[model samples]
Target: MKYEVVIGLEIHLELQTCSKLFCSCSTTFGKEPNTNCCPICLGLPGSLPAFNRRAIELAVTAALVLNSNVQLKSRFDRKNYFYPDLPKAYQISQYDQPLAKGGYLRIETDGNYRNIKLERVHLEEEAGKLIHSGESIIGSDYSLVDYNRAGIPLLEIVTAPDITCGREARLFLEDLRSILLYSGASDCRMEEGSLRCDANISLRPSGSDKLGTKAEVKNMNSFRSVELALNFEARRQAEILVAGGTITQETRHWDEEKKLTIPLRSKEGSSDYRYFPEPDLLPLILEDNLIKEISAALPELPAARRERLKEQFGLDSSEAALFTVNRSLGDFFEEAAGKYSDYKNLAKWVQGDLLYYLRESGKTVEEVDPQQFIELLALLDAGEINRPVAKDLLNEMILKGTSPQIMVQKKGLGRISGDEQLLPLVEKVIDENPGAVENYRQGKDKAIAFLVGRVLARSGGRADPGEVNQILKEKISRG
Candidate 1:
């Protein structure tokens, strides 16, 4: 019997805000351990909570970008739990009244596009990190707690079970991340855990009417890991059912090193943590004008930007998708496109030479001042330097933080425009190499390559190869 896998995701994105969700404490990452914490964010007793307006605006923008319906009223609920990392022993989150719902994400997979429905988008506070023992993986002697991230605003997006396979699920996540980043709602940095995912997966017979019992998979720190974990769990469930065994609903941990999923506990045995409404904060009500303003301010999402870049900039779909991944790279491409009419050539050089220099130097596209890039492209367009020398100048500029124009002046890497400046060297080489001259006379046409090489060596490679080829062909014919 054949089976089909079904999957859905609960993605928590850290909202890019200046302050924490329930307090005025700074929400900056990589601060001195717990330096950004305050009484409310630290879950101190007698400290009342207040919501950050910017966080709500970002959530609204994110929902709008996802095509979600923004609710006029939403309230926060208290999710009670007990963990070493949770100082309050309860997390403040949304329960019945999420801010947004009924959205859909469009992802291209398996040579086709599929729409995945979003159940809801809610606001919540983040939990702290857990440090483990040096020798043991699970056992802990003692762990230091940093409340710095405790109350950071988060947007939780839950998906429906419309995803068919692991690849489709991964594609949906990538598109969602792109939308969030493009909307300026979240940084969506998976490596730093600013974007976290928990997946629910189940398997059933191809023609079955009932949905099989599902398992939740966690500890997927990357997009690739998410796909792998889901693939493994689906196959595991299918194997169990095919062998006439029952599939259990449970929580599983993805062992990335082992490339497998391990069952943690059954859903029936899991703690509820008892969700309730918070009394400290009032319910959030959105004014229609504020929602309209945020909708107007929302930048073009990834799909819209990708389509526009393809149409306006003459970039192919794939090339446009690559260029639109980040705002800095997209801006750089547009600025360079403004100076050069040849979009194909500009795209090749920007994606190839420019990206290479930036990655090798460990700098972002934003780190390179636009003036430096503009001058480098200008030198190439003016024909003052050849392609190889231009690449070398780009490397120097990246490494030493100097402009390509200044480096060209300092190194005298200019074109030898006149043969009067070049013929003398060509003559010396021809007289010195009589055998090659004899070969050229005998109709071995490639022998002209000899004169070109000799001229290049003598001219310090400053001579243009086109001009060198012209002069060499003339002298070799006379010889």
Candidate 2:
């Protein structure tokens, strides 16, 4: 019997705030361990918690963007747990009364769009970071905890079990990151621990509505790992069911290096947390006017902007998707499009050569100048420079941060189109490769291409390829 994979994602986003959620401690990353701690964050005695208004505004803004219905009143509860990383024996988070609920995000995969419903978007505080002496906590002889990240305002976005496969999960995450980045809520940097994800996956018999026993997978750092982990877990569960064995519902870790999942511990239910209302803090109340202001301030999200880009610029699906995810590249392309009418050519260069050079030179889109790139394209179109020269000039423009036109003028890297300069090179190529010339005379149409390549090579890629093609054909036909 075939199996169907069911996946639900729980993502944690660290809000971009200057201070901690309920304390005055610094929220800056890369600080010395234990240096950013304070009485409120360290949970020392005689300390009371205070809410951060900026954190609320940012979270509400994100909720509104995701189409969630922000509640008028939400309260915090104590989530009782004991771990070295969690200085506060209990974490202050939302339980039954969350900030918002009932939203949907549409994702596109293979040219088909589907809406992934959200379960809830609640606010909470982050736990501390654990440093192991070895590769991981399992094999390490000792572990250390740093409370610098503790008390930072965190948003937990939980999704309903709507995903069917690993690839879909990855696509949803990519689109979700783009939307969150556009909302200005979080940086969504996975490497920095600003954004993190844990997936609950299960496999059931095909065409059955009853869900199977799930194993929550953690330690997946990258989007690609998310895909691999979920797919691997699904197969593991399926193999168990196919045999006379049962899959144990437990928590697992994605060992990125081994590229497999390892059982961590038995999974915990909500009852295990022993949640209770916190007496210190009052219930969060948002006036209607504030919600209206936030809703009006919402900017264009990724999905709408992607469709608009396609319609406005006549870009195909893949090109539009590329621009939507890489907002800086889209901005550069749009600004250059204002000064240049060749939309197709501009898209090609931005998506193809520009991206390639950026990866090779360890440069970002911010370092590229829109005017310089357009000038390079314009030079190529006007026949002032050949393709090879234009590519080299583009590389220089990115690396040296100089204008392509200035570089061309300084280096005398103009097209060699004059017959006086090209004829001698072409004649030399003909004399050197007599076999190719003889083949051409014998009516071998492809032989002329080799002769042209020799002439272009002799000119150090500065020769006008079009002019060489014309001159070579004329010379060979006459001979």
Candidate 3:
């Protein structure tokens, strides 16, 4: 019997705040170990918690963007735990009263849109990082803890078990990351620990309403890893069920090298944390005006921007999706499109050659000057340069940050449009390939393309392709 995979994700996104949630310690990454710590964040005795206003605003903004209902009153509770990374032995988090709840993000899978419902979005303090001497904590002879990440504000987004497979989970995360980036809530950089996902996967009988035993999988540092780990976990659980073995509720660690999930320990429920309201802090009460103000001030999100790109610039869905994958890329297109009226050509070049060169040269869109790109397109549109020459100049411009006009002038890369200059090369190509000339003479018109290619190749990609094609056909027809 086939089994269905039920996957839910708990995403921990670090807020884009300069200071820790309750302390003034720097929230910057890549700092010296233990350097960005303070008494409040380190949980030393007599250090009381103080909430950061910016952190609250950001969290609320994120909730609004995700369509979550922000709570009027939310309180903090101490989540009791014992680990070296937890200096206070308890992490201050939300319990029954969270900041927001009941939100959904839409993801397109196989041409169908799925609404992945969310359980809650809560504000919490981040735990410190653990550095083990061995490959993992399982075999480490010694360990070290860095308190710098401690007390950093985190927004924990818990999704309902609405995902059906690994690909859907990845799609949801990609759309979610785009939304967060557009909202300026977090950088969503999985590499820097700004965004992290822990997946809970279980396998249930096909068409069963009841859920199966889930194992929490951790250590997924990228989107691809999340998809792979969940797929692996689903297969592992299914194998046990097929063999009539019982599935256990446990927490597993994803071994990247092994490409499998390893059983870590038994999973804990809500009671394991022993949560209790903290007496040091008061309950948060959001005013109506503040919520309205934040809602009104939200910039154009990804969805809205996508629609506008399609309507305003007449971009197709695929083209709009390509440009709006990231806000920066869409902004670059819009900026260049403003200077050039040919939206179709602008979109094609940006999506095709610009993206290709950016990936090939290890450069980013930000390094490219939009005006310079527009200049290149203008040169091509005006027949000053052919497509091949323009592509080469684009690659060079990306690598050297040079202007297209200057590159053309300095390197004599302009199009060879003059028939007088191109005739010798054309005659040479026809004489060298008598077969092509004979084929064209015998009414095989496609042979002219081969002869035209030869002519352009002789001109170092500077020859205007349209002019070469016309000139070749005229010469072949006369003979």
Residue 191, model 1, lDDT: 85
Among all candidates shown, the one with the greatest TM-score: 2
Tens-place lDDT per residue, model 3, 403-454, is: 9999999999888877789888888898899998999888898888888889
Better of 1 and 2 by lDDT: 2
- Native-referenced Cα lDDT, model 3: 0.93
Runs in model 1 deviating more than 4 A are 134-141, 207-209, 268-271
Q: Put down candidate 1 lDDT per residue, 7-110, tens digits, no spaces.
A: 88999999999998888888888887888888887788899888788999999998998889999999888888788778899999988899997899888776
List TM-scores for all candidates, in order: 0.93, 0.94, 0.93
Worst 10-residue lDDT window for candidate 3 reads 321-330
* Regions of candidate 2 where Cα sits further than 4 Å from its true position: 427-447, 472-479
> Cα lDDT for residue 206, model 3?
93
Model 2 alpha-carbon miss at residue 346, Å: 0.3
By TM-score, the better pick of 1 and 2 is 2
In angstroms, the error of model 2 at 11 is 1.2
Clashing residue pairs in candidate 3, if any? Answer: none
TM-score, cand. 1: 0.93
